[model samples]
Target: MSGTSEGPTPATDLSRPSVTQSDTTMCPSTEPAATAVARQAVAAAPPAPPRSGPGGPLPAAALTPMAQSAPTPVGFTGLAQRPPAAVPEPPLPEPPFRSAFSAAPLAMAVVDRDGLVVSANDTFGTLFGGGPEEFAGQPAADLVDLTSDARTRHAYHEVLRGGRARLRCARRLKHPDGHGLWVQITVAPLAPESPDVLLSVADISARRELQSRLRHLRNHDPVTRLPNRTLFFERLSAALEAESYERGGSGRIGLCYLDLDGFKAVNDTLGHRTGDRLLAAVAERLTRCADEAGHGRTSAPLVARLGGDEFALLVEDSTGTEQLAELAESVLTALQAPFEISGRRLSVSASIGVVERHAAGTSATALMQAADTTLYWAKADGKARWTLFDPERNARRMTRQALVSSLRAAVERGEFALEYQPLVGMDDGRLRGVEALVRWRHPQFGTLTPNRFIALAEEDGSIVPLGRWILATACRQARRWQLDHPDEPPIFVSVNVAVRQVWDSDLVADVAEVLAETGLAPHLLQLELTESAVMGSAGRPLQALRALSDMGVHIAIDDFGTGYSNLAYLSRLPVSALKLDGSFVRGFQHEERGGTAGRPSPADEVIVEAMVQLAHRLGLTVTAECVETCDQASRLRRIGCDTGQGWLYSRPVSPDRISELLGDRC
Candidate 1:
């Protein structure tokens, strides 16, 4: 082996010891060798035959034959002897460090200052292409394929130049026999300030394989075995980043976010295991759809299970909205078929939101949000279909979101107002009552009517507080009207109530409190609900209505004949009036109708007359809505409708206008 010293040569094996006439320094010192030789010389000299002269015993070989066989009575030297002395052998010099380096458990090699392999051990050569000598003069960096990338190449050069303390990196290497392995390469200075470094290679194939398996498990869904939400988000971010950096790319991306309709009922009725199988089946179908969608594209789409029954397909470099729509339509068609789970066939449908756009300024979060919103629109438009993202629709949804977030606050800020429409007696033309309607005086969009925001309120449960506010404000106005018109019959105030108000809030308590607070008689305060909200209402809602009725408040079914009329239900309730739906009135006036220019059809008249006669038999008054002309009012009067409402009487007006109308009626 070569040797290094403080002299001329800069390279040598740091394991072997050597000596020369001019240079005595070596990797291992010579003291142990000299000591070993001295110990050997001392052990080689024979001990003098155990003291045969004087009082010491004679040698066994010199003893007479008779003396050896018989015991000597005085000396007792007849074979009475101690065991032989153990030889004091010299300690073995340590097997050479060169031997240890050559037989190292791990593959090892030494590199010269030029970054070329000075020598490689047997293990190192075995890991490389050939024997130890074959690796001589070869570049260490190329041996491990470290030059494949510029970053790692630069780092290796830094280690060779002794500028870096150490270089530890992992590499994937393929052997000459066609097998592959993952190896960790460690390079560091052989000694302090030594340019020549030792390179150690450790095979870590098993560890790398284990890590890869664990990563796959962590990133995939257990139920469907599809990439999970974490992987989806990662891919989405990566796609966006890649698009941002590449100029030749498609520059557009799209996604289909879908949710299986009525999946909860399946999960609730069937077991989660069955639901899991269904999800897996759905994932398989979605993957096939993605593959089909990407037939002509450079890369296929990614299908991932977001959670539960929701899944997403990501398309990088998408062409446009049309392509995304086609993909969504295909997915809808695919999922429409029955999914057989646990030997029972289950039919399911999916609502998908399709969104596609240029990727230049879009972020993963923004894209996903757009997809989610579009999916909701798909469900809202109708389930079992797909809806492409429309900017106008998105803006409307954003407006709705803003309203929802601010709804409760708006009530506190007093952003709502009430208007009253008078209900007049059809026969006498006297004011019977006023129906209170709500309007939102928005700061950005002025004066939004109930048609715009009532449903939104009902959905988010903000209607509870808002409804309470309407009841209190309307009752106060009616009480003021009574105070102003004491000489005349006190007209009741009718307030429209949402069914949610009955379920979510204490309706009986709210109405009773308002009536007591405003000093209004319960009979003079009327609470109106849609026929749909009134019919089949039991449990809490029914109890609330009955309690309110027992408090002497009138309970009128609004928009009568629009829903399940359930005439049988009316006879059992404390209902006071039925306001015919405006649709029935519109039937008499529409230009496309079969009726004469401005006359009600006999069938329409008969429907109205029968409804009025039935209500009269049930001891309930009837109010006809949407009476825009005197002829409609006269016709309703002939039908025996007790009260009339709509444009003919008055459009819903301010409290002052209603007061003036009441004064006029008096």
Candidate 2:
């Protein structure tokens, strides 16, 4: 029966006897021996009484009553009901995983799955004026008053959603100190765990200040502190775009490109610092003019420093050409006033080229090119003025530039040659000398006279080299002529010397070298200088002329009486002869008529003869120039003129023709 039945064991058997401390007793029972044994052990042990002392340990039964009472299973509601001790935990053994947020050098914080500040580093705590404990449970967004732009917020959301690896935003953080600080916040999401985000913030005030300074340097000229070319072009492009959108309905744009005349001389004479100060002053004046010009207009012109000694203005919505012209005139007038720079009052003038165009297909490059070309025209027309663009004039100007470019190689390529016009002795009909004249044999254009290119050469300063070549060529030809016709009277060769050549180089040395190379007598070579050129001579010119005069090289004043005539100074000069201007010689015809036909008008032959006699008395020989007719030549001869040069004898002819004439005359 015991083997087959499943029934409870007897109470007596279960109540087993007590054993010694070392011995263990076991109870036998039908209701699982383990349960019966547990009950017996609990009944046999005595429960501790409650402690009365303040520091005494709790009684075992009270301390673990639940553990002993029903033997509650582990890991269930009963075990969980017991409160944990209040002792501090060991900081949860710092987490093994490193937070991306904590790795940031700047202030950084981590927002956990609930958008709460789960963790913050020391830097983040200090940045917010709080500790990690204070910030831990707070909403992350609430810690930062993130009232940022919508775009910035969207970027932040993108980082939070793990759509972007990182997001940067410039935000204003409300600091504990009443003032808000600008910070650049970068947010990045943690890997594997999408719910967490890392935020890094940096103060950007100093960086922003640096960026502002860089922007200023980019837009403003370093020297004048005015808008530079970059800014000017930016403004111009904006104006053009605005005008284009307007479609010429009412608005117009005008550009004025001005270059200061004689500014190079100022830079060369004064120091560069002084030149810089002058440029600054010029910019100021231009700014003022632009302001005054745009008083009632839609927009004032924007003035800018384009480059060295150059400035520009952009006039917007001008009424008409008259308005633009008036503005340019005003600029000119404003610059006429003397500028006081570095304690020196210096005067300057500008040549302005202005172009006014409606909102059309005109481009900035085209407009600026037109203005630049027109400015050159203004300068060419004697500077300190303004010129408006004309298509025809611009076309001609292009041709002229092409010509100037071609002219540089003209001398070397044998395209240039000289011709001689005979100067006849007035007393006798014999040829005394010849004036060397330059001619250009252009490939396309026919032969050009000296008047056509001499000025160009002078302007380009090619006259220095061209004039030297002319002197050497003329001397060589003269020497050849003398050798061929030894019986003919010695004839002088007069070479026109340019003022620039006189001032820019050793004129006396050049003349001496040419004479020596050609084996021509010093007296046989005459240098003709314009009266104005002579009068404007400084110390170098005077010294040059004196040196030549000492070497027996004759100096003749060409185009006399046409310049600022100073007879007293002329007497003091080391000049040997005067070439009467064509105007006075042509007047001789009128003089002869006046004497024979009327009661001798003031311009009579008698007055002319008297002037000639006076010139002779002063030991000055007079040569009549441009005596076109034989009658004028005869009159000049009778008036005691030494020589006469005109088309009546011969136009300027080439060396071969001159040689033929020498043969015929001899």
Candidate 3:
């Protein structure tokens, strides 16, 4: 204990605060005694009396002399009532959250439940050019691109209503600088218990531009700036697919495959640069035509450049063949004009193949192939024209291809057989010789004649081998007949030779080999060629014929006078006979009364007489083909025709049948 200095205490200053041990009474019982006693307390004479006021509560420290004049809560709890301890006024918000939000790169904003902007970060102000002061109290709808429309507003509502945790989209926002800002927007509720939403925006303008450029490069031709082959095919495929699914309408599609005529010549004459410019001009014109044709429709036709001089047009929902024909005609008319490039006028024409078909049954690839084939047909019919795809014609061509493929094997398979048509003496009415007609014993078509497969063979160059087979087979049969009947007049056999065979094959060598193999006399084997074939013969072809004639092989010109005949030039070659065309013989008997009806046509008789007289002067034998009636034979004989062959004598019988006829002397 220390000595108590009982100095008279200085008069307590009521104006100043005083400390006393009784300050411990202000602490709650829950506090430790030492904590309660250690608290530095202000002079508290009796706890402030409870105050009455409309306001709720006031702390003892807040009940100041100046505050007493204000309206007091009726149920105010004073110091004696022990007011609920202060809430420790939630520790001042962490600086990091405010700092991070303010420093964020993405535009961010806080929107209240009423759709008003509560707060915005620095990034938001910088991005939108509106500071927090300007943004405050402004409707959130005006700030973000969303909420401007019902669709976006609904999306915002979805995220706010907990239907979605977050929402994202591309939005176009108005910029402060009067330019549009493309942004990828993301939005989310700040908390489940809170009405505020956090909206974040990221600029995506550069990305969109890159994507657009990539798409352009993919779909367009760099030089012509027209849709390329890839885009064309894709459009065609899509059109086909759509047509297949459509109901009750004509789902027909039309395609025009065009190739610029004489384009290569232009490229060679004027440099590639000029060619490229020309191609670009052509593409523009083609695009114009497509647009004009497709005007007033929902979708325009697609025009594209395949490569070089080739271009294609896709017509979706075509009307029919007539409409396709009109389109093709319009394209042709458009191209008729000359293009002036680099101070020179260049003219070009296009061959178009138009193919129209029901979309349901066709594929894109098949349609394009058919178009290509028809385009070739246009070229074949003469360029600068358009050809429609003909299924019947295509079938014929396909059959020809099948035959050409089978022709090489036909010889090895022994599918070929020969028939003999009789040639009778005009005066004696006896068989003098027989023309060998080749027939094909096809497995599918059953007995195809020369007319059906002959052209195909010539086209594929199979005629050379086929012609050799015919010559060899005919010579063998003729030799057999001569050996069988040594006493009878020696009969001859004639084989038709194609122009391709004459030019492509060693005709003289082939005939010589056949004759030597069969031991047939040259005079006994007569080779026949069409007048046009022999008339056009010259150079190697003429030399081939002369060589055959020199080998003692009889040469005859069939279907005489039908071709441009060169009698002056004919005298130089070795031609044995002139067989009058069957057409002239058919003219002799027109339908008249019952029996051998009309009199022989005067014009035909005059022609036959003139030809016979001319042939005799040339020292060439004259034979009349197709002596079907007595009138024809009598007319032919009166005109001094040496021999006649037709159905009147025989209908191309087999070798056995011919031998039987010989034995019977018919």
Cα error of candidate 2 at position 288, Å: 9.8
lDDT tens digits, residue span 34-66, model 1: 222222221122222332232344332221112
Using all chains and alpha carbons, the TM-scores for the candidates as numbered come to: 0.74, 0.56, 0.70
**Number of clashing residue pairs in every model?**
0, 1, 5
lDDT of 2: 0.71
> What order do you get sorting by lDDT, best first?
1, 3, 2
Candidate 1 clash pair list? none
Q: In model 2, how large is the Cα lDDT of residue 75?
A: 22
Show the lowest summed lDDT stretch of 10 residues, model 3. Answer: 37-46
Q: Write the per-residue lDDT of candidate 3 for residues 1-666, one digit (tens) a residue.
A: 001221212222223312111111122342222212211111111123333333333233221212123222221122111223433222222223345555666576666566666555677788888664456556766666566556667767766666665555566666788887566565655534345566666776676666767877998998899999888888888888964448545688889899999999998999999999999999889989888988897566788999889999888888888878887888899999999999999999999999998898789889998999999999999999999999999998888778988998998899999999988888887788999999999998899989999888888887888889989999999999999988887789999999999778788888888898999999898989998888877899899988888889889998987887778756987899888888888877654344455554577778789989999998999889887877678878888999998888889889998887773432
lDDT of 2 by residue, 1-666 (tens): 011132211111112211101101111222222222222222222233343433344343422222233221332111112333454222121221223223434676656545565455566877788764466657775666443345545555655566655544455566776666666554544323335665555666566556667878999998888899999988777767754447544556788899999999998999899999999888888889888887876567899999999899887666678987988988999998899998999999999998988745777788889989989889999999999988898876676676678777887787888899988887767778999998888887678887777888888887888898999999999999899889887788999998899887788889889999999999999999999988766688888998999999989999987888777777668888888888877665553442575232346466567757767877888888898887777777777889889888888887777766663431
* Residue 147 miss distance in model 3 (angstroms): 15
- The superposed Cα distance between candidate 1 and the true structure at residue 383, in angstroms, equals 4.9
